[model samples]
Target: MFSTALQSLSSHLPGCASSGGTSLKANLKHITVTLATWDAVWEVYLDPKWARQQLRLYGAQDRAMEQFFKKLKKEISELSMKRHGRAKQRVLFVGAAGIGTRGDWGGDAVLWACCK
Candidate 1:
């Protein structure tokens, strides 16, 4: 199950050869994780505010949501580093141009590199 989920997330990312923007590549391995579940699990591992914000964005927050986010974050971070190595990679935002709403190429690239 965990491997499947990781594979799903990896498939959403773009390959190094892809010319399209990072968002499209990054979204290759898509997984719909509930905010509540994430909060409940991550809260114990991370800050409550950070976990709450992350879960709220996904609309999945629920009571007793703690540690999960922290664990998830640690796992993801470790996995990402393992995949991409310790070197810092550059990301270029390729989507629309704006402040908050604009697409983040750099962010997408980083995510793809880390998650893939």
Candidate 2:
């Protein structure tokens, strides 16, 4: 039960943005579904206001970003059913971090050369 997440990552992945415009938000539905298949995944957003507005996760309409992600951790740890016949270790830790994705190259590495 997998689906392409093109729409869901509009906020996090920066695909739907055009010409200095904002992108659509679908992180909640996507992350929730993906969590069903994953024990843990890292989501690090530097901007709280932007991330909250973008990650329209279930029950997050009335909660702050901290509350939202804490609930997510809870769901992943206590709720989701593993899709296998055996037990698996699960753990996740979220923290503050920054990355520069505005250009094709940065951070001691060259990801791509969009312009030659």
Candidate 3:
């Protein structure tokens, strides 16, 4: 199930200049699977576009990076599962208004909570 979601997200990710870039795809798959376990789905919810962007920006096509992502996913999944129940969890981000501060924080915060 998690793999399927990762694949779906990989396909949806933008800026794939290379057709043979399965490395990024694989990394994304691993991350999503890990997140599924960890309950970090909130991160994705918080900045879905940013998450996708990271995948693209990293452009990792090496085994080392793949392993790193896989390990991270595993750790995150474990931690998230331990902290949060198996059921989906939600997170909310509230911000205060200030002169030099933009309201950008609330959008993703609200998105993350609502997504879960």
Candidate 4:
């Protein structure tokens, strides 16, 4: 079984990415996390908030950025496992934007990345 967690960022952002991390821990805490995933791929939602935080640095077609996001999320999951001292096989990092609401290139990019 997979223990997935999904957390959305508050629409209330403060000063771009500066205070963006302010709500990170709180948001993460709400992700329904239990035992963290240790060896499985980390599938994180591509929220505009998160995408803007790091994804914006790469070009639209930059493949490296995709892997970068994957590695970053995986590391984060590892940290989560360390904190909990347990490991699962899967987890979900859902962003603020949910299904049928993605209306931007970032949305499409995530789909492509995930599906590919």
> What residue pairs clash in candidate 2, if any at all?
none
Q: Residue-wise lDDT of candidate 2 within 26-114, one digit each (tens)?
A: 54565667877564333334457656765575235324544555565556545445555443445443332235354222423211111
lDDT tens per residue, model 4, 2-114? 12222223344434546545555664555435325422323343445766756554554456746766775677669879988764444333344345333433444555554
Error of 1 at 30 (Å): 45
lDDT score, candidate 1, position 99? 40
Clashing pairs in 4: none
- Which parts of model 4 have CA positions greater than 4 angstroms off? 1-60, 87-104, 111-116
Clashes of each: 29, 0, 2, 0
- Weakest 10 consecutive residues of candidate 4 by summed lDDT: 1-10
**Which structure is stronger by TM-score: 2 or 4?**
4
lDDT of each: 0.49, 0.44, 0.55, 0.50
The TM-scores, one per candidate, come to 0.21, 0.20, 0.23, 0.28
- In terms of TM-score, the best-performing candidate is 4
Instruction: After superposing candidate 3 on the true structure, give the runs of residues whose Cα lies further than 4 Å from its correct spot.
Output: 1-61, 87-116
lDDT of 1 by residue, 5-60 (tens): 75676677647455356553245334334533677666666877876787675444
In candidate 3, residue 64 scores what lDDT? 46
Off by over 4 Å in 2: 1-63, 80-96, 99-116
